[model samples]
Target: MLIDLHVHSDNSPCSCMSVAEILAEARSMGLDGVCVTDHDSLAVLAQIEEGFQPDGLLLLVGMEYSTPQGDYLVYGDVRSLPSGMDAYGLFSAIKERDCAVVAAHPFRAWRPSDIACVTCENVAAIEVRNGRNSLRDDRLAEKHAAINGLPRVAGSDAHCIHELGCFPTRFTVPVTSSSDLVRALKNGQCEPGEAFPLAVGL
Candidate 1:
């Protein structure tokens, strides 16, 4: 199914969409589901409770965090990993808590961390198709994914609706919950895909 694993509502400093906007857009986009991973916050959870009109669009609750190393994608219940910790320290902490840890835009050249740091088993998957990522970043992500025995996942990292499906992940495994999503990621059951549904354009 077409599941977008990363998204941000206006709650994030970089985003402009309200939670309502995100849901409405998800309906318009014909998406099966989306993970609203606002940066370092779970405010979206409240939106779910207040009634998001699921419309069959599963809004998985998660939050993205900026670590000293770079961006960290986290799912499930857990407190912030605290700022200022290096990648290794952050990875160690994630392992201790057993949260699904994914390296966002892992190949961005200017980032503090490198391919070597992300090879650790603590990292659940290497993000290969970040919408905001450049061509160089994409190549590095794929190459690194092959090398480190890590599954390749993608994310639009969308802060806006236009950004939502620009580079989404495609999972053959049915997306039922957060656990299925995580399993698809770790088991390589998903594959990188084009930005949008190919049939729609024709």
Candidate 2:
């Protein structure tokens, strides 16, 4: 019933959560699935996805990009972006692959001008609630999503277990292949539910 579109684990430099801890916390929080979005790396995805079938917790694989435009949550294709690629540059490179690219905390920096070069071709949604941002920032995110005519998404962007589901997003998607989840989100069939805002680096 609930799917967190943004999350991070020990694989990220800023996080320290183990895969087991993620699963347990997801269960405790009553989450149906969580996307493991690590910063600038996809190696952890291979390891995390390897054991998800047994754990019974659906895991979506994704990575974050520190673009000149700011942060982006990316899914679907991983081979296109190498580390150090600028955000706008990464969007161009991954466009052909049709990756799910969402503007992560778009208004968090108060400068959409930086990422103005980010085209809509690869962008899927705008993150409305990032666990690492304040309520004011979250509200700004909602406004950006509406202005862009993109679906609003939410996530803990959790680097820790307790951070799980703090701002979890719920997809109207049925339990199926991970691709179905992506499709559901793209078609505006999903929405963010509970939101617990945080003030990070502000």
Candidate 3:
């Protein structure tokens, strides 16, 4: 299944796309699913869970946690994450939960310590192809993932409508829920993939 693992809706202060617009774009682009990872928020996810299901496209709720080290794409049980916790704290907190964490855009102004965290087993994957990242940054992230033997995932890192399907994570099996996605990531059954043809110029 093709899923964009990182995306922001209007719930994110930096994103201009509404939840409805994101769903429409994802469906039109032929994506099987999308992870709505708004920065440090889950209000939109709660809204969706309440009764906003879109036919044919699975919506997974996640959060882009801003730690002192860097951002992490956290899937499953975000309720335990405390505000401003560092990467180490995050690793320890989710170690016992059925969750997966991916280092988001690792080369985006990353420090040496931050790069080291990508190798941690606790971090299930790395964002090798971020739609908003430069080619150099993406290459560096890809190399880091290879060197660390971590699974690679891609995401639009989208903050607007046009960026919706620019990059996606290809899953070997169908994942209908957050827990399923986390398990797939943890088991290394996914990888980064190209952007949709329609999204090439964006």
Candidate 4:
């Protein structure tokens, strides 16, 4: 299953696209699944009903958790995790729940360096490609992941319609729910690839 592992809907303060807009774009781009990872919150869940599936495209919820080091794409029981925790605290908490955590756009422009944080035992993967990241940023993340022997994933980190699927993670197994995605991520059963060229100035 090809899934955009990180996306922002209207629930995120920086995003402009609504849930419907995101879903339409994902389907049109031929994505098998989309994870709505709103920044620091899962408010987008309100817009998703039980078993929300349209045209066989799976809709899963995650959170782009903010920390002093950088953002992390967190899957599974995000509501149980609190804010203001540092990378170690966040990872430790999520580890106990058997969830997944990926460092999001670690080398993106002005974000703090994530090398140290991503090295933690609890961090499942690192986002090597992001829609909003420059090629240089992606390169840095790629090198870091390679050097650390960490699993790599990708995400749109998309805040708008056009950004969806620019970079997405392809899983070897079916990922029909949040738990399935988390399992895939933790087991290194996925790879990141691009579906379309990113628009200029992303």
Candidate 5:
């Protein structure tokens, strides 16, 4: 299945797309699934479960957690994580829940220390391609993932309509829920897929 493993909705302060709009766009783009990983929040999950259910497009709940070192795309429960937690503490808490962790845009300009965090044992995958990242940034992330022997995934890191489904992680098996995605990552059954060209200024 083709799934965009990182996305954002109106629930995130930085995003302009609503959850309904995101799902509609994903379906139109022929995506099988998308993970709604709003920045530092999973409040949109409830909104998804309550009102949005489109056939042929799976909506998985997740979050982009901020740590002092960088950001992580986290799946499964995040109730144990506290704001401003450091990388090691964040990894330990997520590991306790057996959640899936993908280093989010590790080579993005704002977080130079992300390479160190991505090398940690608890990070299951690294985002080798992010739609909004520069080519050099994506290549650096890819190189780090290769050196660390970690599985690679991709995401749009989308916060708007045009960015959804532009980058996705393709799974060997169908994954319909957050748990299924976790299992896929744990078993190394996923890989980075195609990404749209980066915008002019992004």
Candidate 6:
């Protein structure tokens, strides 16, 4: 299954696209699924059913949680995961619940946190390729993941329709629920992939 695991809908303060528009665009782009990871909120989940799939295109809800350390792409139940905690604390919480966490755009130049600050044991993967990231940022993230022997994932980190599926992760097994997605990520059952026919190289 091909899934774009880092997308933002209008629920995110920074995104301009509505959930309907995001779903339409994902279908048009031939995506198998999209994780709506609105920043600091899971309000998108209220607007859709759990494991929502329209025409077999899944719409899974996650969150792009911001911390003083950096942003994290978090999967699984987030309602009880309180805000204002540092990244390390949040990662510990996620692990205790058997959920999953991925360091998001860790090497991005403008980000405040250092990748080295994120402990490897707590992370399920490193986002090696983000749609909005520069080549240098992605390369550095890739090298970090390689050095750490961590699983790598990718996503469009889309805030608008055009950006969806610019990068996606391919799962080796079928993923029907949020739990399944989390399991796939934690077990290294997925791999990063590029969008079809990119005008420029990834």
- TM-score, candidate number 2: 0.84
* Residue range 33-56, candidate 4, lDDT tens digits: 888888888787777852447577
Question: What TM-score does structure 5 among the candidates reach?
Answer: 0.90
For candidate 5, the lDDT comes to 0.79
Encode model 6's per-residue lDDT on 1-202: one tens digit a residue.
8999989999988889898888667776878888989889888877777565657788888888888888888887776788888888887789677478988998886552358664568788889888888889889888888889889999898887777788989899999888899999888999897565651564
Write down the TM-score of every candidate: 0.84, 0.84, 0.93, 0.92, 0.90, 0.93
Estimate the lDDT of model 1.
Answer: 0.72
The true-versus-predicted C-alpha distance at residue 67 of model 2, in Å, is 1.5
Q: In model 6, how many backbone clashes occur?
A: 0
Clashing residue pairs for model 3: none
Total clashing residue pairs per candidate? 0, 2, 0, 0, 0, 0
* Model 5 per-residue lDDT tens digits across residues 97-194: 85888888877887433786776487888888888788999899888888889898988888888888888889999786667788899778999876
lDDT of 3 by residue, 81-168 (tens): 7778888898988887878899888888743227878875769988888887788998998888887888999999889888888898
Best-performing candidate as measured by TM-score:
6
Quantify how close model 5 is to the true structure by its C-alpha RMSD in Å. 2.5
Relative to the true structure, how large is the alpha-carbon lDDT of every model?
0.72, 0.70, 0.83, 0.81, 0.79, 0.82
Candidate 1 lDDT, tens digit per residue, 5-43?
A: 788888898898787777777757767778888877777
Ranking by lDDT: 3, 6, 4, 5, 1, 2
